[model samples]
Target: MTVTERVRPGVDAGRLMEHITALAAIGATPDGGVTRLAFSPEDVEGRAYVARLMAEAGLAVRVDPAGNLIGTRPGIDPGAATLVLGSHIDTVVNGGAYDGAYGVLAAIEVARTLAERGVRLACGLAVVAFCDEEGGHGTMGMLGAHGFAGALPPGIAKVLDERGVPVGDLLAAVGGDAERLPEAAWAPGDIAAYLELHVEQGDVLERRGVPIGVVESIAGRVNVSVTVEGVAGHAGTTSMDHRSDALVAAARVVLAVRAIAAEEGVVLRATTGTCSVGPGMWNVIPGRVRLGVEFRDVSADRLDAALARLAGAAGEIAAADGVTVTVEPGARTTPVACDPRLRDLVAGAARERGLDCHHLPSGAGHDAQIVARVAPIGMIFVPSEGGISHAPGEHTAPHHLVWGADVLLSAVLRFDEAPVARG
Candidate 1:
């Protein structure tokens, strides 16, 4: 049957916006943004508020060992494999109201609407609020989703929460057991599929005048830290021909990064967002320079090739400047392709609702990427005003937010009705 002909539950725009407004107020910034770092007292309070909402939606709520908040609404068949919907609530410092908040809050609205209208389906529904998806700490980012995928990186043991609390205490504060974090992984088939709704976080949808984006893939990323060493000398006295300048060599490497991403036929993205130079003096030559470079693409093979070329370029530049350079690789995550069936389902939902739909690849990373390892994952995106995100200026129109949630509601019902939902 066509999506339009099927019985569907509708999302309440007023209620959804009210939830967004309330959550935004928890870690409200003076400049109309939010800063609820994961496990911070503010974040904990936000989670409690969401927990109350989940309970009010008539779902049984609990926190997993990895600090993922989950609320379940049972299906008619007690043993049905669940269909999961959610996104993280933790925001980057000074982030806007929508990035991850809309997904989790909207998932709650879906369950609440279903309960309020007495709608039931064959597949159980689960709503999750994942932890720490936007952290900047080394190895501490994407902590919750990785754990939920049963692949938590080992470095988390050395990390501290936003409040400087140890992992054990932080988990305990949220009713999670750090020692049992490994148990957070669900065996295969426990979750039939995963779906997330998020802001476009880029200008694609807005630029194209499309209200929705059906994500094709989340990019695989490789980050490297490069340190260039050279002899410090008096800038004025040193002969230009004989001097080895670290900054000069580092500058070349940065240029190479830009060139690689912008070059013809190169599908990979490269960036050097952070750089540090030592011996800061107008008359003194730089002795050491440190750079943070990253490469991202949907193809792991392409990422590998781009990074290899970068290393070659760095070595050549260092040799030309008589300096030594070392590249230290950092956290790497492979690209994740969305399930074709689910992608079509999202597109169909948008079409049925008369919202313009665009298909695109996510340049930024997401929890849906990690969750893809265990379940078929799909993502729906709404436009971000001016393509801004992870900052105070980020925004999506109120109508766009409602459209994403409404499309999500339609998609969830479509999933439950599919023949493959049986346990």
Candidate 2:
């Protein structure tokens, strides 16, 4: 069937916007942004509000051991694998309103629309609000989704936030038992598919004038902490030939990092977002420098190759500048491709709605990547105003938000009608 023929009026844009506005108000900052860090009081309150919304949508609500909020609407076949739709609600510090919250709200709108229409399908529907996706309070990010996928690390309980509070305690506060977090993991047959609607978080969609982006893959990430050491000396008295300036060497490494990514093409990205210099003084030469280097790409092979080249170049630069450099690896996540079947489904839905669809790769990490381990996963992206996100200025127009939600609704219905595969 043609996409246009399948189109139907679904989500109420006005009601959806109201939900978004009310949720944004929970952690509203003085600067007009949000601060709903995961497991914070504001986060808990926001979850409570979402729970009320779930109840209003006629779904059974529950919090999993991993602190994931799940709202389920049963289908005709009780034993069928379930269709899950959701995203995280937690935001980064002073983050924008739509980053993660939009996806969760969109899922709820889909369920509400289905319930209101009395539409029943073969597979059950589950709307989830994943916790701690924004790396709240120094905790490992994507905590809830990772736990659900059984990919959470072994030492999660021992992990502490900025407040010295263990993640276990935080989980307990939110009705989750860190000791029982293992029980939250879902087996292969538990979920039929997963869907998420999010803002593009980049300028690609906006620059291209496309209303929707059907994600092709979520890029892998590698983070490294680099420290360069050199002898401190008086800036004015030290001759250029006698100086081993750490900052100078660090700057060379940063430039090299950027050049390498540029050589590798658009799929590869490298960044040095943080830099620290010791003995901050105008007259003193820098003795030590620390840089936080990050690399991202859709191909694991390409990411590894880039990291190797970067490390080699850093060593060369350090040797040339007479400085000692140390590189320490941090968090690393593999790249993940969306299910081809599901990707096409999203594209078809957008076409049916008469919206311009663009295929793109996500540069940012997402909960859908973690869930992809167990189920076929797909993502829908709406344009962020001026390609801004993770800040107060981040926004997707009201109509764009509604359009993405409508696409999500269409995709969910299509999944429900498909035949289920069971082990």
CA lDDT of each prediction against the hidden true structure: 0.86, 0.89
User: Looking at model 1, how many pairs of residues clash?
Assistant: 0
lDDT of 1 at 127: 96
lDDT of 2 by residue, 105-151 (tens): 98998899888877776788899999889889888899999998998
Candidate 1 structure quality by residue, lDDT tens digits, 46-77: 99999999999999999999889999988999
The candidate maximizing lDDT is: 2
Backbone clashes for every candidate come to: 0, 1
TM-scores of the models, in the given order? 0.95, 0.96
Instruction: Candidate 1: give the clashing pairs.
Output: none
Pairs in clash, predicted candidate 2:
3-352
Q: Pick the candidate with the highest TM-score.
A: 2
